[model samples]
Target: MKDPMDLDTPLKPPPAPGSDSPATAAPEARRDRTAPEAQRTDAPKRRSILGRVLAWLVVLALIGGGVWWFAFRPAPEMAARGGPGGFRPGMPTASPVVTATVEKGDMPIRLNGLGTVSSLATVTVRPQVGGQLTQVAFTEGQAVQKGDFLAEVDPRPFQLAVEQAEAQLLRDQALLKNARLDLERYRLLVKQDSIAKQQRDTQESLVQQYEGTVKADQVAVENAKLNLSYTRITAPVSGRAGLRLVDPGNYVTVGEAGGLVVITQVQPISVLFTLPEDNIPAIMARLRDGAHLPVTAYDRTRDRVLATGTLTTVDNQIDVTTGTVKLRAQFDNADQSLFPNQFVNVQLLVDTLAGVPMVPVAAVQRGAPGTYVYVVNGEDSTASVRPVTLGASDGAKTVITKGVQPGETVVIQGADRLREGAKVAATDGAAQPAAPTPSSEGPRPQRRPQRNAS
Candidate 1:
């Protein structure tokens, strides 16, 4: 065991391959001590703090922007400049109402009526004598003249009767001549005492009675002639014939109670109408002043004029029951627009005024202080409250007698939510406003502040 190998072991394996040198350990110790300190010193910590601060600033900016926008924006129903149809709450809205021009032209005061057309002359055709109807000369609906024969009665019996009466009259006349000659002879004999006085007087009385008999025979003959003439029925007046009420061979008679046929005149016709009593004064004044009152009738459904005429006559008194006054108008029946009992609406123009101021009735508002209108004024087109006096109203338009001018623009449909001096926007792209119009009334066409359109 005490060999050389044992001696090497006892020497500790040659100092464990230079473990006794401190220089080598020094390098490892320096590395271990400096590593943690270098890591601590070189780490970028300030960058992380700056990143958190930047993120916070961005979040604050976003929140501030949202708050500012929510607080300052206008509400939804309003428009720019606080007018209608553009943008914010409590602003005006587009109106659905219709409007008309404030014209500076004639304004006619009128009286309207309802009317019907009828003929001037009408007649009924009937038999004048009692007889059998032998012939019908006219058709059922034929036009006739005054003397035209309408029908004929059987003439054989009437002719025979007339001849007999004539024969009797001639016999009476011959007897009358013989009696006169006899009376002359008797008078001469009585004067010569050739005959008694009683005899002469008796002869004279006989002659006078014969003369009366001849006169009576003549009258009978004339009556028979008249009866014969009446057998032929003629039209009493010229007119159009209606449907035949009797046919040929009908037993027509003078005693027949009812009418056989009716006839109506067709040429120049007339219309009867009535107007409310409220329109009477105006119409009468115009008529008295020599103004021609024109009247028109329109078809019911289409509102087209079917006839036109002038006021011919008016009733002396108003109809108290209907609160209406009767009027009659004459029309030329050239187009035959008028028919008997035809119903029509009538527009009677009583009078007209030149250069009168009238506007759409929709612009007139019934305010607390009577009637008023909203007039747009200034360069901003702001609404201004104006009191107005109204004249005649035609349901669609009103005559403004005072307060507003002719050419001024009045707010028609945009006044419900509007206040005085609030802005406006005209729908025809004329949003650019003009100056205020002058205040004078009567005939104003294209006011002084009329500006060029947008």
Candidate 2:
């Protein structure tokens, strides 16, 4: 055992070659060697403990920073938008909008209906007598006047009949003349008592029979002449002829379904249109006053005006199935603008409201508040919702019966997203200027030209 309090410590020599015995050393030498190994092991443990402490400290610092940011920091968007925690609150936002001025104008009330062009007279030409068609005098599609020669049928048969009837009439006339002379002689003989009374009566009866035969022959001759005239066919009405149904050299008969030809009078044409039954009262009232309501016909697209005319008459009864009534309008059609069976759009100027306050239709809005408009105050540059009483609208402009005055500006576009007192930036960027206020002059313009853009 080593001394407990040994002060002198010495180093020990290493083992020699070939020495098998385990090497032994003084207590101090052994202590020095073991002390270095223990010191190395303990150094690593201290370093590991110090590193763990540093890792825990860094994690705690990150958690503290996240808590502060999530709980105490303000949102960037809210700050910029000027909310309670906003960066700016003095500036106000204005909604962009387009505007127009209200003006007093003549608003015409017009009714529109789909109509079809019809001919005043349509005739199907046919033969009155049966015969071979020898000649077609009129060309197809040719405009012919009434009584114009159209076609001719074979006249040889009719002419022969006329000759035979005339010859029979001549023969009967000679016999009748002979009988009359005999009857006169019989009467003279009876008066002189030279013959019996019964003989004179028999002779008189024979004379009457001959006269009746001559009269029958004369009737046959007139009938044959009338049949001959029928061989020359003529137009019954003035119109434009259609395609010929029966060509020359073909046999035709009377009352044939497929007639010789069809003719339509287009010069003074008529249009048949329909209107709702609800409109009958107003139309009848105007008609009773002898008013000739003007009507305009438009093309299929309602883009071009084909012709203009006056309302002529209304149908006597309404069409119950469709709840509509038929109306007829007449046009001179001098230029042949309207054709038979052509579909068209018709506009009837019913009545014109004169000198009424009007505004663009786009300015009108319907919402929780029945009908309203956004009236823009020029001085404050703000928009306000104003309720209005509407009268009539011509698609482009509407009549304001109440709640709006002339010379005031109203928001025509961008009324959405607007509050009662919302600020607005108004711009007058419409295609056409406000319509001209109507004058009590000639007549009210039925429709506003499509040039007015909202």
Candidate 3:
């Protein structure tokens, strides 16, 4: 008999569905069906265990990847190169910047103002006598000198009057001569007792009256000649002539409102400008000392120089509304660079501070520090904040009264990226190998520089 539990051998058919082996066959068939059920259950259990292991492996792999990324990943350079304040716990990076040296030079104190070119003299040419305009002696916009002929009026009428006066003078002279001869005869007859004394006196009186008539005629002739000379007109000043107001062949009068033409002096012109009343004292001081303040005139943009001049005079009173005073400067505009009523920019150089510590105006910075600058240290490639004492600036350079010394390196551009102590790379490459140490000075009020406006 085969062991009931150890059935390695194949089981026989359930006794061919017959009798005699009923109990054993039925138990074997039931055993076979139960075994298949047990096999199916075990298969599902094994598959479930495999699935759980795979899921855990995926979770572990994800966690390890996150750890590696957070702990050992490389950082980008952009994070450190943002600015002077951009940094992390890593190697330091240098910031690119532009630099200028604190130099010792003279800084001119100049005052700027709006100005206009003006003519020293403007005149209107008119006729002294009323008559028909026979000829126009000048072209429109022509330049003329003093006493240059400009126009002419009809002279025939005045000439006729002169001739008539001269003829009357000759006739009066003839009568005076005849009266003198008669008076001579009467005087001689009276002396010889050939005539009455009263008669001789009457003859002398007649001769005197005729002499007076001759003198009156002579005065009339001279007056008529003077009137004839006034027909021609001339320029009163050396200047450029304007358009013709009265054309030739038109009747003009001495009382004409428009006149014949306008003339304006151009060479050696003047510029009129206004300055704040506060500048009067300094300007007056210079003038009282017999010093001629130099003035420069530029175009509207203040880029090109138009002329150089000297301050001539100041207005008697200040304009109360604008709180400014008018000033006149005379320029030798030999090239005719200045025109009447032309707008320009004026710069009056009042004073110059010499041998002062100066730096580019761009190097000056203003912030909570009041006014400051960035001084670079080339030895260690670092920039430090410095509170500077500023004086007057000439728009291009500023004078350093204190807080900075000569022969020092200063950052002119790229200062916005700097801090108290920031590493820098001087693109200028002129940063001194031995830069001066930072000053221990504090911030102070910056002196308001020159006011450059009208």
Best candidate, TM-score-wise? Answer: 2
Task: Report the C-alpha lDDT of model 3 over 177-255, residue by residue, as the tens digit.
Answer: 9999999899899889998999989988989999999999999999999889889888999999999998899999986
* Separate clash counts for every candidate: 5, 1, 0
What TM-score does model 2 achieve against the real structure? 0.68
**Which of candidates 2 and 3 reaches a greater lDDT?**
2
Q: Which digits, one per residue and each the tens of the lDDT, describe model 2 over residues 1-454?
A: 7885676757567667765445344665778889989999999999999999999999999999999986775322221265565467545567788888899989888888878899999999888889999999898889999999999989999999999999999999999899889889999999999999998899889888988999999999999999999999999998899998988999888776799999999988999999999999988998898888999988776656899999999999989899999999999888888999998888898888999999987899999998999999988998889999998888778899988999899988788767788877788846547557443222332342245454
Against the reference, the lDDT scores of all candidates come to: 0.73, 0.86, 0.86
Candidate 2's C-alpha runs over 4 A off are: 1-98, 171-215, 377-382, 423-454
What TM-score, computed on C-alpha atoms, does each candidate reach? Answer: 0.64, 0.68, 0.67
Could you give the candidate ranking by lDDT, starting with the highest? 2, 3, 1
- Stretches of model 3 off by over 4 angstroms after superposition: 1-95, 170-218, 377-382, 429-454
Ranking by TM-score: 2, 3, 1
Alpha-carbon RMSD, each predicted model: 18.9, 13.7, 15.9
TM-score of 1: 0.64
Clashing pairs in 3: none
lDDT of 3: 0.86
